[model samples]
Structure formats: C-alpha cells, structure tokens
Target: MTVKDLATLTPSGYPAVSLLMPTHRTPPDNQQDPIRLRNLLTETRRRLEADESVPADVAAAVYDEIAEAAAHVDLRQVGEGLALFASPGQVHVRLLETPVHERVVVADTYEIRDVVADAARRHRYWALVLSEQPTRLWSGDGSTLVEVTTHGFPFTHEGPGGTQGLPRDYGQNPSAHRDERHRQFFRDIVTGLTQVDALDTRPVFVLGVERYLAFFSAEWTAAIAGTVPGNYDHSGPHDLHRILAPHLAAYQAFEQIAALEHLDVARGANRYAAGLPEVWQLARQGRGAHLLVEEDYHSAAWIHDDHLHPAEQQPTSAPAGTLVDDAVDDVVELVARQGGDVTFVGDGSLATDGRVALILRY
Candidate 1:
C-alpha cells in the first residue's frame, strides 16, 4: 500500500480483519509462505467464529475476501512481508519492503499502525532519469527501487533536439531554440508527475548528463534529493539500483545523525521525554513533535486512567483496563497521525533513556 492509503483506508463495516506476517523474497524459504498463509487463515476463522460479537455472515465474508486476496498473491515477487486488510466492502493486500511484527487484529477500524510506522521511518523517493529518447521514473522503498511506467513516466522527448530538427529560419539561434525545447519537454514531465498519486511527497533524484540535468533543474523546483550525472536511459532497474543504493544509504545515515541532533537540542531545552509512558502521555496530548524509538523496542501495556501500565504479555481479552497489544506501535501511530516526525533509531542509541525518546513541540 501507499502512504496515501494509510490515511484513506477505512472500515466499510465493522469486524475488519488485518493479517500481517514476515515473508521471504526467494528460494526454498518462500515455499513455506503458502502453508503459513493457510495457518493464519485458520487462526482468523477461529478468532472470528469464537467471537460472539461479529455476525456469522460478516465473519465469513471477511474471511473469504482475505482468502481471495491471498490466492492472488504473486509469491514470486513477494517482498520481506505481506499484509492483508479486509472488511465486508474493503480489501488491500500489501507486500511490504520491510518486515513487521507478525500479528492479526479484528476490530471496527483497519490495523494500520504498522504501515504508518513504516512510512514514517522508511524513506520513499523518486529517481527521475532524464533523456531525449525516453525519461523514466523509479519508486524506491528502503531496499528496492521499482520503475514507475504509468501516467508520468517513460516521457519521450519528441520536439526540436529530439526527432524533429530546428528549422533553417532560426539557424543563428538554433542552440538556444533547442535548449528551450528541452526545457519545455522537462516541464511536461513535471506536469505529468502531478497525475501520479504514488509520487506525492517523495523527494526526487534527477539523473542525466549535465545539459539535460540543467534543463530539468530549470523546470522542476520541488524537493530534489540530489542530481547524479549519468546515462540511465539504457540502464535497467538492477543497474540503476546498484548505482543508487549507496546514495540512499548515505542519506539514511545523514538523517539519523540529524535526528539525534534534534533530540539533543530538545533535551537541552527541557522539551523531551525519555521513556515510553511519558512519551505516550505527551503524544496523546499532542505534545509530540518528533518521536525517536529504538528499532527493536516493543512493549505491551494496559491503559488505566489514561496512563500506561506494563503488561507481562499482550492481553488476548482485556479483563482489567484496556489492553494494548503493542504500546510502541500505538505510540508511533499516535505521533505520526498528528503530523509528528517518527524515526526508528539504532538499538541502544537510547538505552539509558529506556530505549525510547520524544522531542516535544513545547
């Protein structure tokens, strides 16, 4: 699913089901995916049947929808994880580029905290390759970059310096005319980008030779990650990915360092929370500006009087207060939904601070 889906998805009816699991991309390991899916389907049926709240028809329909969605999964192209969200009228099957905690939830709302967290922490960007023949756009997740071939991509230059040559009437200024035509072509590419919903809010990396890059820079004035001088028109996804991977790695490293600096400044200004409970409270009250979480930290807790109480295990049924299967995930969802920054830092980066931290807006 896309970042837009995180906000747009809703339960068409109650008793929505979310199934999530880590998946393998290749080899003998991926063969177990079907078996694992069948087992989860069985678990889902059990949970729905056991629940007295959900009506029989609704339960059966949701299960069937999920099953249908599962049957269509292209195991050959499966990524690191798979997520299925289904209701009586809604269904979305997502192949996650990163692994998420394996879990299922049946509730009135879709389980999207994991998706939100991934979108918040994992970088998504566009790699725009410029050329006279045909420009291309690629969408990148944390680990993979896939070509975007619809609507705004594979833009071929068709005027002036392209297939058509300059008229003899403008021979003295033919170079200038050619440059302007290329600029206009690049402008069309930018306009085309507007039609692509998946390209929203993603930083761009424009790659081309010096002149083409200059024309593009002159036309598009948005969040460009960087410019790489290259001829990627002939390069396939694998070749382009090999060229772009190191750049993304460096960007991620820079982002982590920048976030740590933000936290330090917040702590110095007395606008930081050091642990989960305090962060949760601040986040609930909308005080969170930036949430910094350890990559491996997860906790299950109970909410009592709006405060979190540590739970020995994730509660199946809440007999005491309200059970939170994963408070860390909840907190991440809370901060991100309110337009706050969320970063999953390396483990032990905040060990003394209980493996979690928050930079408050105040």
Candidate 2:
C-alpha cells in the first residue's frame, strides 16, 4: 500500500510524534527553569499543528529558536527533555540523548541452561526476539527467571595452567549442539512474549537461523496443539521484520474491508451437487459475494433460475463435462455482473469444505 493509504489507517489514541531528550549538556543557566522548557514544547506543538507540510528545516529552526531563548540552559540538559512518541499506525520511535551500553559475559564452561517457556494457543498470537547468545529460560507466569541447566555441552577453559586437564568432549554430532541451542532459544522467547501485556491468545512468529526455524516450527506446532487445544494456526519461516510487516498490512486491510458492506459464503457438504441451486439463486438475486469452485470437480452444465440448463438439453446423451463446466461459467458470469470477488480453491483444501459457500448481501 502507498504511504497515503497507511496514513488513513492511523489509530486515534496516540500522539503523532514523540520528542525524546537525554541528559547530556547542562541547560543554559536561565533555561534550566522547567517553565521555559514547557513553553518551548508548547511553541513547537503549535507550529507542528499549523503547518500541513512541516519539513526538517522548519523543525530545526524551531529547535534553534528555543535554544537561543534558553541560553543559560545546558544543551545537554535540554536534550534530556526530548520525549519518545508512539505514533498511531507507525513504528514506535524513541529519542535517545544518552548512549546506552551493552555488557557481554563469556561463560568459562559449557553448561546446561534453563529458559522460560510461554506458549500461546491462539490463532493470532505470535512472538519474535533477536539474540546472539543462548539465554536461560525463565517462567513467564510472573515467577523469577529460571536458569535451565544444559546437559549436552562443555565450556572451553584457559587458565594459568594453560588448560591442562583432560578436555571434555562437547559433542560428536554437530546437529545435536544446534538442536539444543534452538530448544533453549525458543523457550526463552516464548517466556518473553507471555510477559507482554498487549498480547492475548495469538499465534507467535519465531525468526532465527534455518536450523532453528525448522526446529521451532515443528516443536511449536506440536506444543501449541497440546497446550491450547484447537486455537493454533499459522504460516511462517520468515525474518522478524518480514513477519511483522504482513501482520500490520493484514490488519490495515482487514480494517478497510470491514468498513464496507459485503457478503460471505461458507460451503457445506454436497457443495458440488447441492451448491448448484444456491449458486444459481445467488446469481439470479445478484447477491453472490464470490464464486468458490473446487478445482477437482468437472462439469459443463449451465445453471439458470436454480435449475441446471444443460447445453445439450438431452439429459440422456449429454457429456459429463457439460454439467459442471457450464455451471461454473454461469456462476462466474453472475458474480462478475454483480461486482463480487471470486476465489477458487484446490479440491481438498479448506475452501471446498462446503459445496460452494456463497456470501450474500441479504
């Protein structure tokens, strides 16, 4: 979708922009007053609301103007006043004024690790995480982080003796090590997702190396089925960003589609045989939402006024193809004339569960 289309989907609750400022330079002596900072923010907000096409240059000018007035304020202190805004229908933006540092710790030895596992059994539930090292699993139900001990690996050692003792064999099989690492990763991520307050019962999306992807897909499918019972359904093996993009897009599309008055069809048993009449009725009434046809079914009979109007008219000698093909063509024509969407499905797929599900307007 175009950016304009996306803008139309913006939610109503959140602010359009967030400003973040970190503590760095001292505010100008006179600008140290909170009132001054508040006034600057007020001015900026006013300008933004007034200009339909506010550019970066204009924004910079506003900042400079504020800085000039707050001459006594340390620029660093002003920076800390910057706020983060979570825009509607947009990726959250955080303004950072201070440098954030990450610390790394290398374990002296390979050991079993315990990680938390949180499983969502809902069709829309999904979770994603990015990490370089294997993390310990913790309980996602509000308990403290649990350290799951690993049982199948050994840590490298290099001390004053220059690693003199007999070296413990990590593992003979490379695949085994990969499997263990992934198992821990999945567990930890699920735990983290469960801790998220916004997520209800929904399917989760997991992204990682190919090996982890395969392992998690298989294990998660089974785990969810066993845990939540009948609420799991998903499609993925994509990167975190890829998975999220589609979800956001689908949400937007769903919102737009929901706004329009439309018909929906659910196929029932004997759709191939019994559906012909309903299909014809829907077409005749100009209320067909979409024509759903099973690829495996064959026929050539045209349907009109709820009755099969065979091209040959002679029921005794007509080719079997005439019965099905004509019916499909008739349905297609009817739906198109009425401006409806058509979706064809494989014979055995879920789409064909019913003969022909016709979504109707009435």
Candidate 3:
C-alpha cells in the first residue's frame, strides 16, 4: 500500500497488530517462509489466549482476522517480503517490491515502523518507447526500468517506419490524405495507452524520433514526464535505462534539494532540529513536519526513562522502555503516522550536522 493509503487509517483500540516478515518466491528459502509464518501465527494465538484482559469475543475476532490474512497468502505469488496490518475491522496486505526485515508486533495500534521505503514512496513513472511498428510500455522507479509489454500502432510495414515510404504528395497540405494517416497512427497509440491501466495518472517519458515525438505531444493522454529524442526500436532494458536515467535522476533529485532548503529556512527560524535524539523526541510528540534522513542510515537505540539512549551505553539488562531495532525506523513510523513527510537523501547530505534532520509542525 502507498504511504498515503496507510495515513488514512484511523487508529482503533487494543489488539491492533502488524506483521512484517520476509517471504521468498524461489526454492529453499520459499520452503522455509511459510513454516516461519505458521510459527509466528501460533505464537500470536497463544499470546492472545493468555491475555485475560481481552474479552473472549474480541480476541477471537482479532485472531480470526489474522488467520484469514494468513490463509490469503500464496507462496507462489510471494515477493521478497510481506507486510500485514490487522485492526479489529480493517486488514491491509501489501506486497513490497523490495525486502523488509522480519518483525511482528501485537500492540495497541498497528506497527508501521518499517513500512516506508524509497521505492514505496517515490513516484513510479513509465517510459514509453513509441514507434509505428511496436510501441512499448515500461515501468520504472527512477533506478530500474523494465519493459512490461508491447503494442502495435497503425502501420503496415514490419521494419522501423519513417517518412521514406509515404506518398509523394503527402506534405502538399496539412489535411492531405497521407498526413491524416500519420495522425491516425498516433491516435492508435493513444488508444493503446488507454487500454493499458494507470497510464493516464502516472507521468510518462516518451522516446521517439523527432517527428513522432512532436506529434505525440498533442495526441498523448498521459502527463509526460519528459521526452528523450531517439528511436529506441532495438534498445534493450539496459540501453533504455542508460538513456532515461539522467532525466529521471535530475527530476527525482529535486526532492532532496527542496528538503535541504526547507531545513535551512526552518533552522533559521528556530523551527528545525537535528540529531537522532531530538528528532526522535519530535516524532514522538507528533511535531514532525518533514524528516530528512541519510540513505541507509540507522542507529541501534532504545528508549530509557522516557528518553532515547543508544543501545551500547544502556545497561546489559533489558531497557526500561521500547527497544527499537533502529531509531531511524521508529522516527519514520511516527512521522508518517502523524501525516508528515519523510525524505531519504544521499549520504553526507546531513553528515555535517546529523544523520537525520526534522522540521517541526509548530
């Protein structure tokens, strides 16, 4: 599910559960995942039975939802991971494009501590390689691009098309018969676009020769991300990625720069905070407006005496409060739950100050 979708869920009362686990679609690992999940469900069931505070009916209802969720999981369709959230009446199962850590929580509210990822939050754009013969559609997240399918636009010849085959008097008038045929070819592409789902909402980058690209501007239905000039008729995924990377990167990089600018303005106004401890505090208080975290940044820390303490400095015995796997993850969950935004910037972007920075809601 998208972060925005998760944000719309209003918290219900006790026994709200979040289950995060790694699942495999291939052999050996795939064989073990279901077994692991079954074990976790058994443990959760036992814990629910042992809790005398919960009414029998309520516990049963919660267990039924969890069990139902488990029943829906298909080993054959599994991805690298699974994220399951179950409240009393609500259940959400999101199959991630990337793997997340195996963790489970049975708490007063859903545990979304690890739900946010760059792939999950980033704008998914499609690269359309338009040609008269084999129009193609690709899905990308600014890094990896994959061709999903190909369609045929209106054209008779099998080889790559150009104006060479057009009739001699084609350019005589704007409304000439051959000119209308070319426009009809572009119109067919628009029809193909509508048939494929979600092409209208997501931004699309078009790659084609100058003439086709020029015509597609008026005929295309989707919001165009950008156009790269070339006929990528024989280009493979790697070639397409090489051509599209700089454009997508240049567009996506704006987020980090915008975040840094906001930080500077907020800092000058005494509305900004840096460092894990301060940011974590703001997150807990629901004061986060925007969070800027360095990519792959993590710190082992836990709460102690209502304050955050790095795991290393704490006593060997269990800490007094929550033991978080990573404080960064905790902040992400908190800020997102509060309807704030999170940005994962490149390393060294926040290195001079702190690995994490936040702008306050106040």
Candidate 4:
C-alpha cells in the first residue's frame, strides 16, 4: 500500500484484522503459502468471533471477505510477502517483494508499519502499454514488472462490439468511425482507472507509440508519471523492465537529489532530528515533516518508558514495554501516519548512528 492510500484509511467497525506473512516465489517453499494463508485466516476468524464487540453478521462478513481475498491469492503471481487487511466488509490485499515478518494483529486499526516502510523503500508504479488491439496495464516495483489482470485491464478496441453490445453507425466514414472508437476505448480506460479501480492508486507511467499516447492523453485527465514514446507492445516483463529501468533510475535519482537538498535546508534551519531515538521521539509527537532514511538502515529496538533503546534480538513476548522488531519501520509508519513525507536515500547517505533523520514539522 502506498502512503497515499494509507492516509485515506480509518478505524472502522470493530476489530480491524491485519494478516501478514512471508511468501516464497519458488517451488517447495511456495507450496506452503496457501496452507499458511489458511492458518492465518483461521486465527483471524477465531479472534473476530471471540470479540463480543463484533456483531455476528459483521464478523461473518469480515471473514467471508478475507476468505474471498485469500482464495484469489495466486502464489505464482506473488512476490516475497502477502498482506491482507480486513475490517467488517472492507478488505485490501497487497503483495510485496520484501519479506514481511509474520504477524496476526487483531486491533482497532490495520497494522500498516511494514506496508509503509516497504512502499518507501520499493518504488511502485504503473506501466501502461497503449495498444488498440489490446491495451495493457502492468504493476511495476523496482526492476520488476507484472501484468495486471483484474479491474478490466488489457483492454482492447471492440469495434462496433456486435449485436451483444452496442452497434455503431454503419453510415459513418470508415476512418472516422475507427478514430472515434479508439478515442472512446481510451476514454473507457480512463474511466476504469478513476472510477472502476478508484481505490487502487499508483503513479501511472505510460509506454506507447506517439499515436496511442496522443489518444490516451487527449482522453485522460489525471496526471501521469512520464511516458516512454515507443512500441513496447510485444515486450515481455524482462524486456519491458530493461527498458523501464533507466527511466525509473532517472526518476528516483532526481527525487533522491531533491530530498537530500530538502534535508540540507532543514538542517540549516535547525529543524531536523538526527539519529533514530531523536527522530522517534519527534515522530511519535507528530512533529515529523519529512523523514530521510538510508536504504539499508535497520535496528532492532526495545521501546520502554516512551524511549527507544537498541536491542540485539527482538523480544518474542513483550513483558518489558514493547518489542519493536525494526524501529526504523516503526518510525516510518509513525511519520507517514502523521501525514509526513518519507524518502529512502542511498545506504550511506545518512552518517548518523541509526542512519535515519527526521525533519520536524515544528
């Protein structure tokens, strides 16, 4: 889930079940994903049913929705982790390339820490290949690109659509009719992105020839990330990734440079908090305006007495105060939930102890 979608989330109904588990991409290991998912669902079902605050119907709806989502979990399509969030009738499923620590939290709100941190570290976007025969949409994360099959993607030009659907005017000029049909087809794609898949949000990056791009641009109103004007219609995921890699790198490089500049300005104003603990405190207080973190920085920490301390191993059961598996992810979540920006820079960008720094909103 992107931070943009996280901002729209709120605690709803009774128990908000957040089920996350590590998934494997290859054989032997991947075979157990379905069973593991079922186990998590079973646990979530038990917790929801036991909670008296949750009405029976509401509990059932949540379980059914979660189960329905679970059924669609294709191990072949998944990356390293699968996260599912369910509250009453609402449900959200996300696949992550980074391995997620398995946890079953039945709380008032969805556990979004790992999701936030992953989204920050792994750049995700949409790669749309425009074609009249069959326009395609792909989900891109870092160097990988996967085709999207749901929400009526891979849309094709259905000329006249035959008697089953609507019939076009046969009297119109052939070229003009084809042009209108193409424009209308592109418009339908826009409608799907904004209307049909309204909740599924991402920065769209278009890949197409000049002709189709012009057609799509003319019909689409929403802002796109950038366009690569070429014929990638026949390109597979690997080839498409190779072509998009340079573009993605350029985009990220520009963003990283801009973020470093922002951090420098914040430092000059004495409005930044360096190191994890200091940033943690400010972030917890909703004072984080922006967080700049080194990409590989991670620290296991114990949080007690409103303070954070470095830990060698994460405490399994928190009899102490609380066991923060990765305080860096926690800090990212805290800042993001507070409407703050987060940027992951090169691993050595921050020379601080925790390799993290926060620009205080204060």
Q: Would you estimate the TM-scores of all the predictions?
A: 0.85, 0.25, 0.67, 0.77
| Count of backbone collisions within predicted model 1 | 0
Candidate 1, residues 202-252, lDDT tens digits: the string is: 667778899888888777766667788978789887787788887877776
Candidate whose TM-score is highest: 1
Could you give me the TM-score of model 2 versus the true structure?
A: 0.25
Residue-level lDDT of model 3, residues 1-362, one tens digit each, is: 34544555544677777778888879977889888888878777777777888788887888788879888988677667787777677777766655677776778777665556523345567788877666677776445466665454323323213454544564565346555667777777776665654433455788989988978787875567689988898888789888988887776687689889999999899998899988999889989999889887888887876688787776455545667778887787778878788887889999866799999989
Per-residue alpha-carbon lDDT of candidate 4 for residues 1-362, written as tens digits (9 for 90 to 100): 46756644665666788999999989999899888988988998898889898889888888898889989978787888888888876888887777898878888888887777777788778889998657888888776787887777878776653123444567767666667777888888877666533666666788999988998999888887788999888989889888888778777877889988998998899999999878898888999999999888888788877888778543455456676789999888888888888889988878853588888887
lDDT of 1: 0.81
**Candidate 2 lDDT tens digits, 1-362:** 11112112232232343332333445354245455446546655565556556455554454444344444444442322233222323322222222212111111211101000000000123333223333222111111112223331111222221233322466545455545655655555444544441233333434345544554555443233111111112322232234455653454345334322232223222222226555666666777655555544434564333366545663543343234433554555456546654444445443433445466554
lDDT of 1 at 180: 81
Candidate with the larger lDDT of 2 and 4: 4
Of 2 and 4, the candidate ahead on TM-score is 4
For residue 280, model 3's alpha carbon misses the true position, in angstroms, by 2.1
Candidate 3 — which pairs collide? none
Q: Candidate 1: misplaced stretches above 4 Å?
A: 1-8, 42-61, 97-104, 169-172, 194-199, 300-305, 309-326
RMSD of each: 3.6, 22.4, 6.3, 5.5
- Candidate 3 global TM-score: 0.67
Local accuracy by lDDT, each model: 0.81, 0.37, 0.74, 0.81
Better of 1 and 2 by lDDT: 1
